[model samples]
Target chain A: MRILKFLLVKEFKQIFRNKAILVVIMVMPVIQLIILPLATNFEVKNIALAVVDNDHSDYSRALISKITSSGYFRLSGYCNSYNEALVLVEQDKSDLILQIPPHFESVLLRENSERLFIAVNAINGVKAGLGSGYINEIIQQYNQQLRSKLQVPGKFNLGPTIQIQSSNWYNPNLNYQLFMVPGIMALLVTIVGGFLSALNIVKEKEAGTIEQINVSPVKKYHFVLGKLIPFWILGNVVFTLGLLVAFCIYGIVPLGSLITLYTFVMVYLLAILGFGLLISTFCDTQQQAMLIMFFFIMIFILMGGLFTSIDSMPDWAKMAAKFNPVSYFIAVMRMVIIKGSGLYDIRGHLLTVLGFAIVLNAGAIVNYRKTF
Target chain B: MHSVIVSHLTKIYGKEKKVAVDDVSFSVDKGEIFGLIGADGAGKTTIFRVLTTLLLPDGGSASVGGLDVVKDFEQIRQTIGYMPGKFSLYQDLTVEENLSFFATLFGTTVAENYELIKDIYVQIAPFKNRRAGKLSGGMKQKLALCCALIHKPNVLFLDEPTTGVDPVSRKEFWEMLKRLKEQDITILLSTTYMDEANLCDRIALIQEGKILSIDTPANIIKSYPDVLFAVKATNMHQLLQQLLRYPERLSSYAFGEFAHFSFKGTPDTDGLVTYLEQHGLKEVMVKTADITIEDSFIKLLG
Candidate 1:
């Protein structure tokens, strides 16, 4: 431990001496946390709604006004024929067409019911699906309004009503940053902590100081730890600063226990740092280490479910994500912060990350050559 | 007991099988300043690397301070200091920081070895706060030597330490090594400059991964089998080309102020003088000269 302490001191001295790297470390994650979330929203909006009305009646007009008033959609046009609606869609002016059948008000008054058709441009799957669902909900409310105006009995209202209500529990507002900020925190930590530790030994090799270290009595584990701990601490600093930005700028407060969040962070950092050390042992130059790190980091990010849902991915991609440590970090970061989950909820994830840490670091220590 | 011992050491690098160090063996007694004299790629650095436990021998074994290099490497590392051919100090750290860090790595402090490095470190102490990369070549050399000696190892392996320093710094460094020798620290260093071989108690002249001779400086010169001669002319460059044409020229090379040559057999000095005069060479002087390490090295290579 004495040797390890001195080694850590040296690592810290070397790390802080590079003012450019320190500046990059302290400032970058905060900027990313603030700016990146705004551009990655999944909530579909500004859907172009086109309406075709055969009977220009109060009831139909009321429904049209109701559809336009909701902010989820923009009215593209009111057309006379379906072909005109099709032309609007082809022109990219409209993405949905709501058609009111002939004798719409008459059927609504006599039978107290009516049916409408919607021709949606399905090129953009999310916009098309959500647009049609919004129109359907509006018509359902209209049907209820007509029955109430006629003072109809409760029999029809009770006939077959399955009131489906959903609550977007953790993020009720569905703010994308609330979802993205935590995941981006995972990415920032991986890039900073992983790349820095990966370059540590290889940089020594390039500078030739590694010969001095290798010919010393310092154990391989001590050397690897000295390279790892500083970057791990820096990773946490980046994580905490990002959380602070999420709270102050985006008004986001993690619902989970800070204890749970921090615990997982320690384990996740261990895994990432070990992976970095593994890369350092295999590479002889910092550029080679950086290139190999970039290749793996890219794979880790793309397959880690940071930007995309793992469940939505193809089977092969999902299978590949199972091996990616970054995916576990992102999962737990989101689970603990946005979902406010407890340690009990993330125990499985914690174990997986811990396992990765042990295996990768053991490999690093074993693979490092005392005589090179 | 010897400070370091090697037997039949061989190191081969690359899939192309370049023999870096081949079938080499030598020993250094405690407190002796031993030199490995060779040009670049002559495997002097390779021998130092093998002895210092920075590299493994492909075929043979070495021991430092009575610990086998392959089996007891950890213990061997504690008793040795290695300065690589290049300046290997951290460029980002201050000199004091670099010194203190290396000291700490060896489980000691600079204060503990102040008596050993004080003479060298005092010269560069005022620039302790300066980053190492900005220091001049001489200062870097002093600083590297200070760091290597901070732990007070039983043996020091310095590979071409004065390769690029100014002559003044080079002389100062040798003075420091001599003072280190007073403390009974075995010094094994490699140098391409043949003149520096005289500074050591003994040297091994090596080339192309082979050792040609190992002896004290005086003995190696006395062991020369050929009669040596020094010849000079007005056109030194043309003189070099002309001397190579001499039928009896055994090994000829341009020494600092004159052309030092030797012959396969004793030459008629008056006849050589006549040949140079006929060639329109002016200020011609021909005389027998004593053999130096450089001349010996050239003769061995020839």
Candidate 2:
């Protein structure tokens, strides 16, 4: 315990002494929290839609008017021909294009049938898919209005219909901030925790202090543990601070008990600290440690299901994600925050994270003592 | 019992079979300052690491204070204080903090062992609040010494502790070690400075991962086995060329301001002076100077 205390004090002194860490901990988190969420959106709102009405009759004009009035599509331009609409899309001037067939008024009245063409920019697949869905809804609504006007009888004919009613729990509005805040909390904590611990040991190597410890009465295990615990606690503190900022600034309230959240976070920190220790042991310089950690953090965050859903991934990718500790932590955080799942519900995630912590720490302890 | 001991200690770094410390065996008696003098990459640091239990030898065995380095590694760690070649204390912490921290690590207090490090620690104590990283090269050297001695280890292993420090600091550091020797602590120090070899009770001049000579500095210098002389004249370049041309001059090498030479047999100083005058030289000085450890080191290498 005394050795642990000495190490903790040293770790604290090291962390608080660096102005760079102060900026990363106190300032960077706020900046990212404020700006990152505003830029990240999957709902595809406020799409810029354009239309070309070659059929200059009442039928085509009415269809165009319905599309323009729809809340989903923001009509920014009315082109004269297909070529002009294509030009707008190719130049990235518009997200979607709606074209009405020529002689649509004559054909709709005589034949009781008409066709409308919808061309969507597929460069951004998600935005294009949403735009196509919006245009389809508008055309269906206009056709229903025309049918009601030519009503035959009060009796209705039976037909097949498909409907999807999604009941989004906790965050019924599906606020992206609500989903992103917890994931970001995990990412920030992991990064700072891993980075600082790696630097702590590597700084020893750089300054030649590891030699002092190496020659001193302290055992390698004592040294490695002394280095790990302080950062583990710090990682938790940063994790909690980030959670508070999420609540205070973004109004993102966690539905689960804070104790459970903290418990999972503590377990998660072990894996991160282990990774940092491993990096420090392998690297001779702090710069090398930082670069290697930056690479690891990049891969972990990108594959951690922070912004993307793991369930939506391909089979092999999802299988790979199952082995990723970040994926489970993020999934567990979302489950608890959005669904308020209890320990029993998240027991699998807890076990996996616990196993990861043990394996990584074992590897770290063994590798950390190795001579360079 | 020796303060530190090793027998047939060999360490191979990798599968490629690079031998760092090869069948090395040495021991230091208690209360003695021993020098392991060598050039860079001469396995001096590797030997220190092995004895400190920082690295396990691929073969053979070592013990510090009667405790096996590998079998009783923890005991060895508790018994020794190591200062590596690089300045390695917590730079963020102040001098006092680093000293106090290392003291506490050994289950001891700075106050409890104040006498053990009082002299060296006092010199840097005034700046106790200043961070270790911000201190000057000499101050950092002192602070490292104070921290290493804080625990009052039975043996101290300093691996080239004064490598980059200024000469004055190096001199002062040696004086501190001389004082520490009174406390009966075993000191095993490695250095590249041949001058420092004289300060040790016994010195081992090492090269290419091999011990070339091990003896008291006086004895090593005395055993040069030749008639050595220092000769300097006007146009040293031309003088050196002429000196090397003589077959009677067994060896000749520049030493500071004068050229040191060894002759195969007794040479007439007047005859040599007349020869130099005839060769068109001025301001010639011929003198016999005491050989230093560096002189012996070069001779041993040769």
On TM-score, the candidate that comes out on top is 2
C-alpha lDDT (0 to 100) for residue B4 of candidate 2: 81
User: How many steric overlaps does candidate 2 have?
Assistant: 2
Candidate 1 DockQ score? 0.66
Please provide, for model 2 over B22-122, each residue's C-alpha lDDT reduced to its tens digit, 9 standing for 90 to 100. Answer: 77777889998999998888899999888887787888888889899889987777878888777888888888888888888889999998998888888
| TM-score for chain B considered on its own, for each of the candidates | 0.97, 0.94
Instruction: Report each candidate's C-alpha RMSD, comma-separated, in the order given.
Output: 4.3, 2.6
DockQ by candidate, in order: 0.66, 0.67
Q: Write the per-residue lDDT of candidate 2 for residues A22-78, one digit (tens) a residue.
A: 788777677777777777766777678888877888878888778777767787679
Name the regions of candidate 2 deviating beyond 4 angstroms.
A152-170, A369-372, B268-282
Each prediction's TM-score versus the true structure: 0.86, 0.93
Angstrom error of the Cα, residue A198, model 2: value is 3.1
Query: Local distance difference test, per candidate?
Result: 0.88, 0.83
